[model samples]
Target chain A: AQSVSQHNHHVILSEAASLELGCNYSYGGTVNLFWYVQYPGQHLQLLLKYFSGDPLVKGIKGFEAEFIKSKFSFNLRKPSVQWSDTAEYFCAVTSGGSNDYKLSFGAGTTVTVRA
Target chain B: NAGVTQTPKFRVLKTGQSMTLLCAQDMNHEYMYWYRQDPGMGLRLIHYSVGEGTTAKGEVPDGYNVSRLKKQNFLLGLESAAPSQTSVYFCASSYSSSGGLAKNIQYFGAGTRLSVL
Candidate 1:
């Protein structure tokens, strides 16, 4: 089974501060990477995903992620953040073939942006 | 449009009690999955169904059973609840396309919080 590791457990930043969350997976083959965010009392929503294309993928709310195959990492980043961006972020990965139906998720990173 | 819906938003069970969690999807997806989320353990898959009448085990499937009688409905059952089973359960569904960029993008439910004492 593929495993995902998130570098940070919790992060705090002020408004307009740059934010970056580190995520790495343990798969070496073809893989699909994703970032999902869950706001307070809300279900998880897709931030972005990378299948097979440019390493850098942009998502909603000014969020973007870079998929570095060499490092086995797909890190999420945002130049500026707002109070609304304060939520729990999860990094997930799924490989090809019969195992595509399963997604292995990271432990998650909680971001708190103070306004 | 309710993409995926999980019944009984909150549930409490005794040590030996039995309960079922219901999941329904209106998007006509071919794949459905059940996962449990703990404090810092992230989400762990308990069971999944590729199509109607077909189910498979995931990373953590012990003490849990699942049934897919209809294409739109998936049921997860616990014959005897345990404290370790206490967590927020989420149901997700995704369209099964052979070769598409949006094939496995899962849509998740609001989740059901379960507590076993």
Candidate 2:
């Protein structure tokens, strides 16, 4: 079975601080990666995805993630953080095989950006 | 367009009771899914539907039943609720793999918080 791992359980950062959340998966085959964010009292929204293209993918709200195939990691990053960026972030992955449509999500990382 | 909506934002059920969760989408998506979110556990898929009249089990489908009688509606039922079933349930919809766009991009609903005591 495939599983996703998020190393950061909770992170507290000041405004304008750089952000980096680590994510890794346990699958060796072809895979599709995604990052989703859930703001306070808001639905889960897609931040970015990686199928087969540039390793670095930019998403909404000045967020970006890099997919490092060799490391089996897809880490989410932001050059600078804002108070509004406080939310719970999830890293998910799916096999590129026939059942690639199903997603396997990791334990989310809660980010708190203090102003 | 209300992408995806789940009814009864919050519910309280006693053990051994029964209830059904309603999920509706106006996006005309061919695929619908049910998931449960627990503290520190992210989300676990309970069931999914490829199309109307077709349902399939997912990662955790032991105590849940699903029905997709209409293309725009998907229902998840708990025949006999248990305390262990208390969790936040979410419904999502997305385009199928056969569609031009990738099937991994899913639109989720505002989840339903259920408590069984």
Candidate 3:
């Protein structure tokens, strides 16, 4: 089973500040990466995903992520964050091929964007 | 369209009590999943189903049982609840992409917050 690791447990930043949340996973085989965001009292929503092609993928709400296979990292980044960006971010991974039913998620990073 | 729906948005149970969590999807997806989200632990897979009548154990399936009698519904049952089982439960559904041709993204439902006391 693959294990995902999120570097920061909590992050605090002011509005318009750049944001980056580090995420790493442990798996040697072909893996699909994703970033999910959970707003306060809301369900988890897809931010972005990287299956193949360009390592960098753009997602909703101006969020982006870069998948570096060499480092087993898929870090979420945003150049300028808004107060609404305050949410819990999770990194998830699933092995490629037919066995993609299970998703391994990281511990999660809570980002608080101050206005 | 209701992609996925979970019943009993908030539930509180006593220890050793039994309860069931219902997850329904109208997307006609082949894959359904049950996960528990804790404060620090993002989300841990409890159980999953591949097709209408097939079920599989995930990373943390202990104390949990799942059944998928119908194609659109998945039920998660806890025979005896424990305090450690208290967490926000989420149900998700996704279409099975074949031959790695497309993305197998899962759609989640508004979580069911469960508290076992």
Candidate 4:
């Protein structure tokens, strides 16, 4: 079974600080990776996705993620985060196979950006 | 576009009560999904439909029933509600993949907060 793990449960950062959220998935074969963010009182929205491309994928906002196949990790990073970046982040994966198109998601990490 | 919308944004149910949660998508996408978000539990897939008449069980489907009788709507029913079923439910839609890894993003609804006591 495929599972996703996110190391951090709650993260606190001040405005202008750098941010990095770790995500790791247990899947040996090719997989699709995704990061979704949900602001307070909002729905989850796609942040970035990696199917087949350069290891680095950039999404909306200043966020980016690196898909490291060997380490089974796809960590999200932003050089500088603002108060508006406070949200719950989720990492998900889907095994690229016939029986597992459904995504498995991590427990999620809550990030609070202080101004 | 209305995107994905789940009705009854908030509801409270007594144990053993039955209710249906409706999910509707206007994107004309070919795939619809139901998920429940619990504290420390991420989103667990409940059910999904590939097309108007086709439905499949997802990771957690034992206590729920689903119907996708129309292309734009997917309904999730709780035959007998329980406090354990209290959670925020999300609906999502995506393009057709025929069981392949989908690169297309899943558009989500605002979510329905259901509390079963």
Candidate 5:
């Protein structure tokens, strides 16, 4: 079965520090990738998505991810982080083809930014 | 619009008790899904509905039942709750764009946190 893996379980960083969360997937066909973020007491929101075209996709809150097909990876990155960025991030994938439309999500990474 | 809304933000149930989670969406989305969120387990789909009156099982459907009697409503029921069923539940909906086309992003509810003893 297809699955997503996020290497980091938890990450702590000072405000203004750069951030990167690793995500890898196991799927042989074309896939649509996404990054979702959940802030404290808020619903999960889409940060960015990579459907086709550009490998580098920019999302809300200055977050971006690069889809590397060969590596089967779509890692989320931000040059600088803010205290408000402290939240949980999830990576998801959906293979192309039928309208099965199911998303496979990674375990998730919790980031804590200290001021 | 209230994209997706789930009722009873928090609930406590004892083993063998039963309850139903109500999910409503005003976006006129054609697809709705129920998922459980647990620590270390991002989100496991429990059940989904493609359209009104149609329901299907998802990744983790055991111990859960679903009904989509109305297009804007999807209900997830726990016939007999267990401690293992304690977790945060989320409801989401999305529009179907057809045949390999990119679908609308899923809109999630704030989530219902359920504790079973």
Candidate 6:
């Protein structure tokens, strides 16, 4: 079974402030990691994913995440934030290496970007 | 192309009432999924289908049933609606490769907000 955990429940940041949201996962086998964002009145959108190759993955709207294998973490980061960035972020995982594509999602992190 | 579309944007049902939610995707993806989202709970998988005429249970399939009669359509049914079944349901699809690494970049619908009184 694959599970995901997001450390922060709610985050409040000012515009132009750096941002980092913690995410961790536990699965016996290898797993694929992803970060998804849900803006107000919108469906969940894919931020970025880490399947293979480079651990540092960049996403739309200036968002990025690093996949640390040793720590079993895939934390989302951004150099600067905007008020429009306010949204709920989710971390998800799926079994890797020919396993079925069943996604397990985290509780989510609510970001409130103050302008 | 309409990536994924869910019908009945909002619904309210009385206890013991039954209803069905419709989902359609035009991307010709191979994998389709149904999930429910609640406050603080994120998205929990209810059921999924790999292809037409095939359906499988997911993390939270006890209270819900799903069917994939056609390749582009997936239906989720609530036989006996309960208060616990009230949630925002989302449908998603992905193009899964036949071999290693199924490539799971899911495209999601706007979601259906269902409330059971």
lDDT for each candidate structure: 0.93, 0.94, 0.92, 0.92, 0.92, 0.92
Minimum summed lDDT over a 10-residue window in model 1 chain B is located at B95-104
Give the Å shift of residue A73 in candidate 4.
Answer: 0.2
Q: Write the per-residue lDDT of candidate 2 for residues A1-101, one digit (tens) a residue.
A: 48999999999999999999999999999998999999999889999998888999999999999999999999999999999999999999988755568
Model 6 Cα shift for residue A71 (angstroms): 0.9
The sequence of per-residue lDDT tens digits that candidate 1 reaches over residues B1-117 is: 889999989999999999999999999998999999998889999999999999999999999999999999999999999999999999999888766445568999999999999
Highest lDDT: give the candidate number: 2
Residue pairs with clashing backbones, model 4:
none
lDDT of 6 by residue, B28-115 (tens): 9878999999998889999999889999999899989999999999999999999999999999998867665655788899999999
Can you write out model 2's per-residue Cα lDDT over B1-117, one digit (the tens) per residue? 888999999999999999999999999988899999999999999999989999999999999999999999999999999999999999999887654346688999999999999
lDDT for each residue of candidate 4 in A1-115, tens digit (9 for 90 to 100): 4799999999999999999999999999998899999999999999999988699999999999999999999999999999999999999998865445578899999999999
Candidate 5 has which clashing residue pairs, if any? none
- Model 2 misplaced stretches (Cα beyond 4 Å): B97-101
> In model 4 chain B, where is the ten-residue run with the lowest total lDDT?
B96-105
Interface alpha-carbon RMSD, every candidate: 2.2, 2.1, 2.0, 2.8, 2.1, 1.6
The true-structure Cα RMSD of candidate 3 reads 1.2
Report how far residue B51 has shifted in candidate 3, in Å.
Answer: 0.6
Tens digits of lDDT, candidate 1, A1-115 = 7989999999999999999999999999989999999998888999999887899999999999999999999999999999999999999999955447688999999999999
DockQ of each: 0.60, 0.65, 0.66, 0.62, 0.64, 0.69
**Which scores better on lDDT, 1 or 3?**
1
Q: Judged by DockQ, which candidate is best?
A: 6
Q: First chain TM-score in every candidate?
A: 0.97, 0.97, 0.98, 0.96, 0.97, 0.96
Q: Which ten residues in a row have the lowest lDDT in candidate 3 chain A?
A: A94-103
Interface residue Cα RMSD of candidate 6 after superposition: 1.6
lDDT of 5 by residue, B38-83 (tens): 9999998899998999999999999999999999999999999999
Candidate 4, B6-114: lDDT as tens digits? 9999999999999999999998888899999998889999999888999999989988999999999999999999998999999999876654555246889999999
